[model samples]
Target: MRSEFCNALVGRSGNENVLFMTGDLGYMALEPLQEALGERFINAGVAEQNMISVAAALSRQGFEVWAYSIAPFCYARPFEQIRNDIAFNDLPVKLVGNGGGYAYGVMGPSHHAIEDYGVLLTLPNMRVYAPVFNEDISAVVNCLSSELRPSYLRLGRGEAPDGYVIPQYAAWRQLTYGDGIVIIAVGPLASTYIGAFEKLPKTQRPNLWAVAQMPISANPLPSELLSQISSAPALCVAEEHVKRGGFASELALYLAEGGKMPKQFRHHYALAHTYGTYGSQQFLRSLSALDEGTLLSTIAEFAPTSV
Candidate 1:
């Protein structure tokens, strides 16, 4: 996906105006970006904070700057830089963060970015996108090219799960619909939700919506779409990150403001409030009940009337 992003940016009509900056990482896969877009690419040598500030400054000078780093370094380490530089200035800087959540697995808690969404979502003028598959990544890139505000794209380390094939340049798409309950699943967890849906009889499947890109602007949610969801008997939000300030929390706040409260709700997310030792991604997922079995059980237990 990173390679695809680089190639797509290089082939754009105004490739000369594109700038790519990284914290001296991506040494193996990002050589071409530096070789081809030499004048437009910078290796900021491990300074994540400075890199963001520089990217914002360059964006102000009319360059479409993209900053890349592992998730922890990209967002957590330089959160203030992101807030005051990119977000405050409303620069057109695209933050391409690799290995979101437990994607880094054995890289340890220091590298895991289970709290990035919670942090990034608080910054004003910043949009967040977590593409579930290859197609979704392409769509997000296309959207970011024309977008005038700061944007962040959280990507996994390996091949994404195959479930929804979002169309190129499409910002959002709905995967399923029902009246009894509304299940909002984001990122790769959407694929897990599809599997959970299969476990239920067709008649038991609740209304479901898969939003790959959850923008920072709270009011952009289509009122018609939200009304349908808010009208359901119950609502559940599932995501790969923590519960606070993540998709579930944000959706809950949205519904609360609309004066529609579902009788039952659940925010199935990580509980890693503290750091831990290095381990495999699968192991970490199970520890946090993000695996298939756990997710299915949670959905079954919270399935509206089942409550």
Candidate 2:
């Protein structure tokens, strides 16, 4: 995906408007970017704050700047830089971070970016986009090209799940439609819900929505989509990240404000209270109860009855 992003950026050469900067981390993959756009690409070493500041300054000068790094190092460590320099000024800087959540599983807590969404969503002008698949990534890249505000795109480490083919860069996508229950799954975890759906009888399947771009500034809850979900007897949200202030929490608040209370609303996300020791992503997911089996159990337990 990094290669794809770099290739896309390099293809925009003669325009002289696009600038790509890295924290001296994309040595192997980003060589093409540096070679093609040498004057534009700046390797600012491991200093994420300095990288963000420079990107913001470049944006102020009317250049499209993209800053790349690992998720935690890029956002959590240099949060002040993002909030003050880029977000406060509403600069058009594209902050792309790899290894979201347990994508860096074996690397442990220091590398795990489980709280990135929670943190980024709190910033006033920052827009967050997490694609579930490669196609969605392409769509987001296209969408970002036209965006005017500061945006953060969180990319995964491994291959993305095949949820749905998103032709456009909409904030959300409804993959399945049903009346009994509504399930909102964020990022690659949407595929888990899809897997769970296959385990159910056709009549037992609930409505499912895949959120491609979860932007902080943008209320992704379109009225039409919300209305459809509101009609359901229950709602459930699934994510690989922590439950607190993540997608589930945000959607719950939105539903509360809309005055559409489901029979039972549940969150099947990572437990924010505990951070596990280093392990494979699968082991960490199982340990945190963010795996498919747990999700399936949660859905079965919360099966809605006609109101």
Best by TM-score: 2
| Full-model lDDT, candidate 1 | 0.72
- For residues 10-53, could you state the per-residue lDDT of candidate 1 as single tens digits? 66635688888898888677777677887677899889989999
TM-score of 2: 0.89
Best by lDDT: 2
**Given candidate 1, what's the lDDT at residue 46?**
87
Number of residue pairs clashing in candidate 1, backbone atoms closer than 3 angstroms, sequence gap of 3 or more or interchain: 1
lDDT, residue 214, candidate 2: 64
lDDT of 2 by residue, 18-93 (tens): 8888887786888888888877878888889899999999999999888999888889888999999998998879
lDDT score at residue 295, model 2, on the 0-100 scale: 69
Clashing pairs in 2: none
